[model samples]
Target: MSHSGILTLLTDFGLSDPYVGVMKGIIAQVNRSLTVIDLTHHIPPQNIHLARFALMTAIPYFPARTVHVAVVDPGVGSDRRPVAVALGSDPNAPMGFLVGPDNGLFSGVLSQYPALEAVELTESQYWWTATPSSTFHGRDIFAPVGAHLASGVPLQKLGTTIAVDSLVMLHSLTPQRTKHTLTGCIQAVDHFGNLVTNIPASEVNGQTWYAVVKDVTVLGRKTYSDSAPGELLAFVGSHSWVEIAVNQGNAQSVLNLGIGDAVQVILNQPHSSQGD
Candidate 1:
């Protein structure tokens, strides 16, 4: 079969390096007609969780059969295995592909879809050049392999089949819930300074609540304008997660909150009216 799906790239190798570019070059060399999109090239160094979250958010936006290649391997030079995964719960949908280290970066994606197919990438000579480098497999190995796969190569030809249980999984953000209270932690801080938390919108519906962070209670608002510009407000975010943001300011800096900080949603009525 001829290759016809989109190939997407995600990595912590910032644009300053020739790493990402070289990978693309290798892919183009294998299949010139393949379309490539750069999801991001600025993930924090070795921040696998951030990479996983970024991948999950971008995958749904692409058309079916989109091949996603991610490389955030801190253990690149180590004994870790490179992998290619096809994600989909329904057997009929065009399966999504992931080419990267066998680290826990695929955790979030696998969590949302349990029946994903996984395989270890073992084809060596078929890589970009005759000899591959230990430190930069993204260019030598993953890129070429992904391009070839996108070009209609059967996944089984890449390597031997493996059970999903054998793959690595990262620990995702967990939200704790009580009678009416929900507690979660900040998972990441985006470029716009918004603190993305683990609390989902389903946890706070039909209830009045306060987002308590570092002892400061941020009032829940229906929208950003419900508060003065640059003032902090808590609202249900685009991903169905409750977010702490400022209309035109950076909530991460303004509130001095960082990842793993404790955030609580107290569902009880505001304290001021309790005595009335």
Candidate 2:
């Protein structure tokens, strides 16, 4: 089911602006036959942590060889390197291309797919222009480069090879597990205001769990129905993380939470103290 010659774009640039459209236009100009999928255009501006989590969750569903262009760059005009990463090309691995700035926006997906090959986009010829706008690398660099990659241009030819370890990775909050408590940080806030924690859902599988955020102890539930309407509850989200949500309500508003907010998850009884 791998869709070749397909490119997926994710950006903090909302639909109101022409930025996302312009990037698509550049991609189309480079390769008219390629299919461009708009993964999303509504990522909160400058929210790299949320961008990372979104990419991580969505990439597993895309077919192999789809190029992913993510632009949540806060350092667009700075000296940050523009990068294109080829990941998970092995037999049973998830294969895709990640195109964006060298910031940690790609880190979440990289944790799962480990880089097969990565390059700094130094070849100006592949970009839309020789003198790209310092502020908008999305249109000038990432768009065209991703289009070229999806159009079958080789990865190495795009730019200089760099060590996978050298790539910038965010020191995002990793969940710490004790016998009965998991301490982590919120990594994303969904449209419904459900707070997604860095803690993996598997940790509390088949066990009772509750979450404490902003000093409120939320009851654990198997689903939203476990709580009354507008009541905040915690549950394992369908993806990979634990989510704190209020049934038919905005948890973000109730908790006054945002990304990086501290989260304490209390689970019942003993599990092996692996991450302690």
Candidate 3:
């Protein structure tokens, strides 16, 4: 393996352990000059859907040819295939490579770059350890193959090619829409405790709507700052999705919300005002 562009790491293995460090060590052994950036290691432990969203939101910021290794495999030892994906509309020019389990972790990335090619990381020639562990493929299989890909190895050379359509899709993460309402699940709760919903901001289009989260209703605000301090409000978040938040406070703490909680955004009913 030779020197290459950025190698990113996204995992549920928090910094409290040596799992992340060991993976990087393997990458370093393969290509000492490869710059490894920690995209994030705090993925909430085996939460594949959250990992999918995080990857989707963050990948566009990196330069082309970046190799991303994301490991949030709760089914690590199972029949779930270890895989590598190359994102590109053109078969000849790959945007980048992603190495991880074949679970929904890569679904968002695949959705954005529909032309991407994928393959099961079956070839031991690309992995770090000959006898890979059942539980820790992140350190053994994913890390080294990502390093090899960063070093300019062809996608096909890694293993047998699989269609992107065949990858495990995170279909449930999408919001359900009706004539008067858009229903979605809480994809994640950020550090600030804002509930990030799968409902895109376009669905509401900044219209007057009321958000029902955890059975509590709050009128939509343009921004968190628009609402009174400690008052719960729903707004278009940074990623262009509707989020449940509290101005100057934590919604997750105040409202007892968690990931996968249901959220609904419905068109606000007009009141019969005297002027109207």
lDDT to native, each model:
0.81, 0.88, 0.84
Error of 3 at 234 (Å): 0.9
Model 1, residue 81: displacement in angstroms? 1.6
- Report the number of clashing residue pairs per model: 1, 0, 0
Candidate 1, which ten residues in sequence have the lowest lDDT sum?
267-276
Q: Which ten residues in a row have the lowest lDDT in candidate 3?
A: 267-276
Which of the numbered candidates is closest to the native, going by highest TM-score?
2
Per-model TM-score, in order, reads 0.91, 0.93, 0.91
Candidate 1, superposed: residue stretches over 4 Å from native: 1-4, 90-94, 271-276
Query: lDDT at 129 for candidate 1?
Result: 67
Best by lDDT: 2
Clashing pairs in 3: none
Instruction: Provide C-alpha RMSD values for all models, in order.
Output: 2.8, 4.2, 3.4
Task: Write candidate 3's Cα lDDT for 55-117 as tens digits.
Answer: 888888888888999999999999998999888886766777889999888887777787478
TM-score ranking, high to low: 2, 1, 3
Alpha carbon lDDT of residue 102, candidate 1?
89
Runs of candidate 3 exceeding 4 Å displacement: 1-4, 271-276
What's the residue-level lDDT of 57 in candidate 3? 84
